[model samples]
Target chain A: MLQIKDLKATIEGKEILKGISLEVKEGEIHAIMGPNGSGKSTLAAVLAGREFAKITHGSVKYMGKDLLEMSPEERSKEGIFLGFQYPIEIPGVSMVNFMKTAINEHRKHRGEDPISASDFLKIMREKKALVEIDSALTSRSVNEGFSGGEKKRNEIFQMAMLEPKLSILDETDSGLDIDALRVVANGVNKLKRDDSATIVITHYQRLLDYIVPDVVHVLFDGKIVKTAGKELAIELEEKGYDWIKKEVDSE
Target chain B: MENDQDKIISDATSGEYKYGFYTDIEIETIPKGLSEDVVRLISSKKNEPEWMLEYRLKAFRKWQKMKMPEWAHLKIPEINYQDIIFYAAPKQKPHLESLDEVDPELIETFNKLGIPLNEQKIFTGVAVDAVMDSVSVKTTFKETLADRGIIFCSFSEAVQEHPDLIKKYMGKVVPSTDNYFAALNSAVFSDGSFCYIPKGVRCPMELSTYFRINAANTGQFERTLIIADEESYVSYLEGCTAPQRDENQLHAAIVEIIAEKRAEVKYSTVQNWYPGDKNGVGGIYNFVTKRGICKGEYSKISWTQVETGSAITWKYPSCILKGDNSVGEFYSVAVTNNYQQADTGSKMIHIGKNTKSTIISKGISAGKSQNSYRGLVKVHKNASHARNFSQCDSLLLGDRCGAHTFPYIEVNNQTGIVEHEATTSKIGEDQIFYCNQRGISTENAIGLIVNGYAKEVFNKLPMEFAVEAQKLLEISLEGSVG
Candidate 1:
């Protein structure tokens, strides 16, 4: 469902993601673990079509289409959703209206009629319960004056609303308490399906316990130095990234 | 006619305006130039009554003796009145009897502006009277509005059909000699709307007038007067847009409102005229005089405006609190982008005991534009216990933009309490990045931040206009952020 070949990304003329190649089939969960500034979030931003990132040379194909050729909004409508590490606050723009617009914009891009307001509300209520997202958060402007936990949960809540095929969670658990992390991980676990895939980007191994990934990759510098099973996250947690760096250096 | 400051100011509005499109529409325009004979010709064309002609003559004489105001914080070249035409209407356009008689190009302009007048039911609770150039293309909801003892029609017809009402309130708030442009507007005003709400009636909808300037080198002089009688309430809205012109055009307008005892009047304006190109060579110079008077005890008047257009805007819609316990309020959100310059705010005069006034203004400057907020609040000795609260906030989108606030507060009453506060801030990169990290696009983020900053003023506009204004705020600052 996704293919990135030699993904070389730079921001402000400085190279960040250097020669990254990855492929994930449908129904698989892939986790990328790295220390701070290991280009973990940069990968997510590049995949989400952020304009500030410079794609010096690379080919990213989503569903066999040239992803780099599309705009951020176009990529979003094409079922590519990135759960922002820090959600935006849009004061005066209620969450309901924002979701409704996103939903309808995606629907319009598919040449479909807008969902009725009543029907839209029904899905929103149902998804709100599934994600454990507070009703108050849903009523307020998108993430305006929200807590860190609420912002992360709101991203998951929107993921449920849009139902994107490829969901990239960027540091969803960075600032979450254990309880909040459980709720966020639970939401992601519930959304996983046989036809959809999830790419979890995180620094800690704790979040991996809740949303167990089928594959774990270590991102050192700009490239993934090693790909392992779920046990690899535990190994790194016990030994720390410095131990792995020495082992990779010797190898 | 050129200097460093003038060049800097003119550089703000240099570029083609979004609405400046050339359409192949037939028009009936008079020759260029201004004179007493032209004023007489306009009055004769309207077939005005003898008294109105006399009034026009009086205003023309006042205009002749008055000198142009140069004190405003603007950089506009001298206007050669003789080089501009005074009157123009569409060819084959008689008194509009039906919507079909309206010019298709004018309707197209409104359609592009997202203000289609044919809609029967929509937000903003009312009908719209679309005035393109010098004529009203169509006035909607006439039957419904007329049923409520309301008189809504062109100023020309009002002079003929409701002369008694026109005579009673015309120039009652802003007299012909109030300012230089006002005298000019009164002298050769072509056409505008006049509305009257009788005693104890509340207007059921939001009344709107859209002015579209299409003809070249023809100044737009319009006169609008609305009166709410005793125990009545009414809200009136006006907006305008013009085609691009390399030669600067003049728009001098006068608006007066009167509220009787226990009556309320709310006036809102969303002025978006063609503000000359990025270099400010040919945009409209909006010199308007608008004032309202609360004549009876407990009367109230409120003015709200979103001025985002015009090359050099010089307007100060004001209020006179003459009635005991009367209230006055002014809320404004003015924006200057590119070569635009606006020195606008309002003045409030308190003369009656216990009169209260409130002023809230937000100014936003983007690109190389300059925006200023000039306001005055005065309380007379007789206005015991008079209270006023003023808050002004200015937002600078880019570092090159300029924002200035000039407030004059005068109090002669020992019991009056007055307070003023102002702030200036930039759309900091941190705030934007914080929003972007949450997946919201930069454009939507700017809109959200601006709406939050201008919420106090946006709340002053009617609900529908507020929504439209919010979207317009987003559209106006599209490239300003990125």
Candidate 2:
């Protein structure tokens, strides 16, 4: 469903993601485990078309279309969802209104009529139930004064609302307690489908316990140096990334 | 991406002012220049009483001695007073008994402005008094208002028919010697609205006045006076627009409101004078003095204004809480774009014990415009336990624009509780990108962010005025979303 070939991204003249290539098919959960400053977030930002990150030399094809050519909004309309590590707090825009505008814009891009008010509310209720988010939290301004756990769950709630074909969860478990981690992972697990794919980017292997990945890739020095089955996460968690760094250094 | 944002800003700043069309109406204007004879001409032309003429002469003499204020953070060029026409009135039937008697061109002009003068077509429960150039052409629902002992008429008509009320209340709140603009407005002010709600009576409908400036070189000095008698309640609205011109026109207006014992008054304004072109060569110099006085115990007065036009705006709609336990409020949203400059806020003077006041001012500056919020909260020695809360927020759209806040607070009584807060923020790229990622366009995203930023003040306006104010904000900030 998504393809990246030698993707090199830079921000402020400093290369972050250097010579990175990955491919993910439908119904697959790919976990990219890396240490700090390993360019895991940069890869997600590049896929989401963040304007600040410049793609120095790379090709990202999503559903057979060049993703780098599209704007951030167009990428969103094309079903590319990037769950930000630090969700932005917009003080005045209510989550309900934000979702309505997003849904309608996506529908407009697809040549479909706007969803009716009743249908919209029903979908909101259904999505709220999926993520176990409080209705009051969803009614307020987007992420304004929201708890850390609530913000992560709200991201999942939005993912459920958008129903994107390719979802990239970047450090979704960061700052989340065990209970919040379980709720968020369960929400993502429930939304998984045969035609959709998930890319879980994390610094630790703890998040993979709840939302198990089919393929685990270790990213070191802006390149994925190791790829293995789910058992690789357990081995890395037991042995640590230092051993992997030593191996990559020698290679 | 930066180029895309620059394009958006340029497009928003370059959007045309939609209400810049002039009506081709023959106007009878006094020759340009100001003098004793000119003031007398305006007074006599309105058929003012001898007392009114003496009042104008007194104000004119005071204005002659008073120099234009230079303290505001504005770069105002020296105004050539001798070159401006003091009065201009559209030529029409002298007396109008019904809508049909009014000139067709005048009716068409109002219709184009979406203000229907025809009583039957007015779906909202609003009585409108239409003022063009110098004179008030018509005031709708006058007889219906008169049935309830509610006096709603033109200032000229009040001077002629209800001289006692005019004599007792005129310049009582905002005196003729208030300031430079107030003195000037008092001298040459031709016509405006006069409304009086009787004791214990609530105005049946919202009272509104639409002012338009059409004649070239003519300065519109309108005077509006509203009085809510003891136990009475009323809501008054004012709106203004001017034609596009190469030479800046002057709009110096005076509005005075009085709320008696247990009375309540809500005054709202949507000022959309011509804001000149992108280069800021010409527009309206809107120097207005609007004040309300709570004169009796438990009285309440609120001023809500959305000022989005004019090349240079210097206005401070203030309130004087003179009665014990009285309440005063000032809510404003001022927007300036493309070389427009505005220095506006409100003054809350707490003179009575235990009085309270609130001020919420939001300023949005885009393009090369500069917007400043200058406000003062003063509590006298006797005003013990007087409380005041003030919040002023400024939003900048582009790097070239500027926003400033000047809040002055004075409390003589130790028990007075005063709090002031101010914040200035730009429309950050992250906020824009967040909205864009949600599928909203940059234009709509700016609108949403700006509206949300000014939502507090917008909520204080009447429903219709709130909608109009939002639209004006969108227009004023159009294409300014870099």
Candidate 3:
């Protein structure tokens, strides 16, 4: 469902992603293991259509269409969700209002009538239950005073609400506690469909324990240097990025 | 991202003024000049009493000797008094017995403004006094109000019908000599609404005056007076709109209100006069003086305004708490887009013991506009146990715009308690992108953030006025971001 070839990206004249290539099919999950400054989040941001990351060379195809051609909002309407590492805090915009505006815009794009208020409330309740998030969060301003873990869970709740075909989770498991992590993982697993795909970008193998990956890739210095099965994540977690750096530099 | 955000904000300022259409009705206009003779002629044209004519003549002489005040943070262009037409009214019968006798074109104009003169067609439960240019076209629900001893009519009618009340309270709150604009308005003011609720009575419906400036090369000077007697309560609304013009049209108005013992008065304004073109070539110079007084113990007065138009808006609706234990409140949301500039706020003067007041002002500036909040809170020596709280917040949408606050507080009594808070915030890039990533457009994102910022002040407006104010905010900032 997605393809990337020789993706070289830069920000502020600094190369962050160099000659990267990857592919993922439907019904599959890919775990990208990378150390700090290894361009994992950069890739996610580029795929999510962030404008600051200039693609010096490469093309990304999603659902057989040029993904780079669409704006961020258009990409969202096209069923691509990016779980931000740091969810933005928008004061005075309640979660209900934000979600309703977003859902109506998506409906408008799909040639459907806007959702009724009662239907929207019902859907919001269902999504909140599915994500195992507090109902109180939806009544407050969007992420204004939410804790780090709550913000991440709110992002997942939003992912559940939108029901995107492709979701790129960028460090969503970083600040979560064990119980919160379990709930987040269960939310992702529960929302999984045979026609959809997920890309989990994380540092360790802990998250992969819950959401098993179909394939594992090790990235170093803006390039993925190794690929294997789930065992690769365990090996990396045991030895860390030192071995990956040694192998890549020796090449 | 910064460049894209700038493009979006600049795009927002290109929204066309929606109420900038001129009617094609025949109009009668006087010569362009300010003189004793001109003032006398206006009073004579209205068939005013001798005393009313003398009032106008006295104001004219005062205006000639008073120079325009330049204390505001505004770059006002010099206005030549002799270059403006003081009076312009639609040519029609002097008096109308029903909506059928009104000119069809005039009716169409009011209808276009969503203010129906025919009472049967209105569902908003508002008693309207529709004023076009220099005269009141019609006032609805007059007899219903009269049944409860409520006096609701045009200012000219009040002078002729209820002269005692007019003589007692016309300039008690805001005198003609209060300011440069007030003097000019008092000298040549053509027409506005006058409302009075008798002692112990409650006004059945909202009293409103919709002012439309339809004639070319003319200034609209309307004087509104409202009085609530002992134990009475009334809510009055005022709305203004003007046709588009290449040269600036002046809109100088005066509003005075009084609340007697245990009485209450709620005054609201939604001023959407035509702001100039994108280049700031032309628009209304809105200089207005509005004030109120709590005249008896336990009385209350509240002023709520949503000002979204006019090229230059210099207004401060204030209140004087004269009775012991009286209350005063002011809530305002002023928006400046394109080349508009607004300097507005409120003033609270505590003169009696145990008085209280609260002020909330929100200003939003977009494009290359300038918005300022200037307010004052004063507790007199005799105002023991006086309490006051004031909050002013400013939001800026673009780097080119500006937001400023100037708050003054003075307390003479040691027992007085006052608190003031002020803040300035920008429409952050991250906030906009967060909404955009959620499938909303940049324009809608700006609208959401702006409305959220002004929600506090908007909550004080009545239900219908609040809805219109929100829509006006959206339309004023539409397509700012692409």
Candidate number achieving the greatest TM-score relative to the actual structure: 3
Q: Where in model 1 is the C-alpha error above 4 Å?
A: B1-31, B44-58, B89-149, B157-167, B204-214, B276-281, B333-338, B360-369, B381-404, B411-481
Where is model 2 chain A poorest over a 10-residue stretch in terms of lDDT?
A45-54
Candidate with best DockQ: 3
Scoring the B chain of model 2 against the true B chain gives a TM-score of 0.99
lDDT per residue for candidate 2 within B166-241, as digits (tens), equals 9999999999998999999999999999999999999989999999999999899999999999999999999999
Alpha-carbon DockQ of candidate 2: 0.61
Of the native A-B interface contacts, what share survives in model 2? 0.53
Once superposed on the true structure, which residue ranges of model 2 sit more than 4 Å away at CA?
Answer: B1-5
DockQ score, prediction 1: 0.13
Q: Residue-wise lDDT of candidate 1 within A12-127, one digit each (tens)?
A: 78999998999988999999999999899999988987656789988999999999997677778788888888776665567887777678777887899989999999999999
CA lDDT of each prediction against the hidden true structure: 0.84, 0.92, 0.91
TM-score of 3: 0.98
Tens digit per residue, CA lDDT, model 3, B219-283: 99999999999999999999989888999999999999999999999999999999998899889
Ranking by TM-score: 3, 2, 1
Which CAPRI quality tier does the interface of model 3 achieve?
medium
Q: Candidate 3 has which clashing residue pairs, if any?
A: B8-B480, B8-B481, B11-B480, B12-B480
Candidate 2, after superposition: displacement of residue A70 in Å? Answer: 1.4
Candidate 2: residue A2 Cα off by (Å): 2.1
